[model samples]
Target: MSNDPLLDELRAHEEQVWDALVRGDADLDASLLCQSFLGVYGDGFADKSAHVGQLAEGATVQSYALTDLRARALGSDHAMLSYRARFMRHRRNQAEDMYVTSIWQRTEGGWINIFSQDTAAGEATD
Candidate 1:
């Protein structure tokens, strides 16, 4: 998380996603996503169902962490969060790092991720 007040709040909601992924808790994952949630990945975009369905398909992340988190408020009920994430896939035994941006909207139900875009952040070279 950054020094921005808005980013701090957004970071908490974003953390929920990581927690759900590492725990393989699809229900909790779904709770953080909007019904029409759209995730833009390197391959393409995934809707809320398909995104959370990865867990059901047995995709497990053994460990994960986030850093360099930054956020901007779009309006009173909306925010955009960006961060660098590192995680290992248990099935593949490979670790990956990426920069991600997720758009969240605060509704009566709470903050739900409405959209996300991930960019592969490879190893830093000297």
Candidate 2:
């Protein structure tokens, strides 16, 4: 087995999260989100259930493409991940993109996402 425990753990958790989002896995989504999670949406903040419920509703997240994914350790128990997600909204029949940042903390039950913020990649204005 490898020795870099921190890096190995972080990598594993990151993959778990990304896979969940891409596959629209409600169980994994709920499991990874902290009970006190604060998610900053396009314009406001939502609690843990409110955020995860969106995924659990099975509202057809047709294709979530992640790019420029990177993770950095923030002290001993926290990690920050940044990435851009390009996804299609099946309900609206539209394509959308956003820049996302998620902060995760190692908890007794494993890794849980404590904070998340997403900004829409809007069209440039001249």
Give the clash count for each candidate: 0, 0
Question: Per-residue lDDT for 5-94 in model 1, tens only?
Answer: 788888888888888887889999999999899998988889999889989955378788889887888988999999999899867677
Error of 1 at 43 (Å): 1.7
Q: List model 2 lDDT by residue over 5-100, tens digit each.
A: 654565567567666656767788778888898999876889877866777656456566767777788988898878787888656678898998
TM-score, per-candidate, Cα-based: 0.90, 0.76
State in Å the error of residue 111, model 2. 1.5
Candidate 2: which stretches are off by over 4 Å? 1-25, 124-126
Error of 2 at 85 (Å): 0.8
State the number of backbone clashes in model 1.
0
Highest TM-score against the true fold, candidate: 1
Worst 10 residues of 1 by lDDT: 57-66
| Alpha-carbon deviation at 36 in model 2, angstroms | 0.3
